[model samples]
Target: SFQIKINLTAPTLIFPGIEAHGPYSIVGKTDTSLIYLNNKDEKRVMYLVEIVKFCDATLEKVLNEVKLRIFQNKFWKKPPLLGELDLDIMKAYEREITKRLRHHKQIRRWESFVNGRPILPTMKHM
Candidate 1:
């Protein structure tokens, strides 16, 4: 019988600073075994995935969406500022979206590398 093991850790997100959004990085590993019945040999393969939002998507699609405002010409339009509202709601949404994008990017980046190399670094594990 052959045995395979899979190990996954919690995802990690990093916020550079107030000005900079972040460079979502997801780091994890998996281990599996491939046994050759004829050759009586076993091979192990590791798989990893990461995605990076180094472009406008990070701010426009993600951040803006979470901001819950329509943006035109690089400007965000919010509801009338005449009402008093809970600031915590905005903060919670922002944090959640930020973390989600970061984790998602990490996975996407890894997948892109595995699929093919397009002027990008080669993936060590697939």
Candidate 2:
């Protein structure tokens, strides 16, 4: 069996006088058998269906929808940091989410490479 795991750790930020929060993590895992017999029951191949499914769900459904929503609203507090950065804290949150998403994409690509099956280009390219 082969196992692949990926984790994204969100940073904890501290404004000058305010307390720190988070440094939370989100993890995704894939497990697959090394060999699978085909329909004819005469051939075995490196079975990566589980890994592909995991990567698809993690990158598209979980990361893009669920995690982005959490980062945009759930984990952010606006009024507290309004005075510190001299700008809307929402902007900072947006920047942080973008950075984290980019990092996650890179990690996914690297994981795909290591597993010998690269993923197709994401929606951004199309």
Candidate 3:
């Protein structure tokens, strides 16, 4: 007969020599330890060092996705023909675009005022 002992401890940020935390998803567990999956779906051993590195890389990927979404949405307006095809979706897009543009304009105005400069500099100064 074989007796196996498992240490079912809640995940901790501190290891013997390293102190770091990660946002890893537990996919499975073995008799000895848990298994984790990183943002890229890569399997990682459930240890403090591996979890920390996986979380850092996952955070970077999330940030990049946020930037990509922002870039795609900014300055994007629905075509007029789209309104004819799908009125609700087109209207929603139009409203969102308008709101974003208004917010951008307000930010520009605030920046110019704070910096004591016109939003568009004079051609003579250019």
- Judged by TM-score, which candidate is best? 2
TM-score of each: 0.30, 0.31, 0.30
User: Top lDDT: which candidate number?
Assistant: 3
Model 1, position 115, has a per-residue lDDT of 64
Candidate 2: C-alpha RMSD to true structure equals: 17.2
lDDT of each: 0.35, 0.36, 0.39
Evaluated at residue 5, the lDDT of candidate 3 is: 86
Show where candidate 3 strays beyond 4 Å: 1-85, 122-126
Candidate 1 similarity to native, TM-score: 0.30
Q: Where is model 2 more than 4 Å wrong at Cα?
A: 2-87, 121-126
Off by over 4 Å in 1: 1-62, 65-85, 119-126
Q: For candidate 2, lDDT tens digit of each residue in 63-125?
A: 343344445454587533223332333333334445555777888877777667657565222
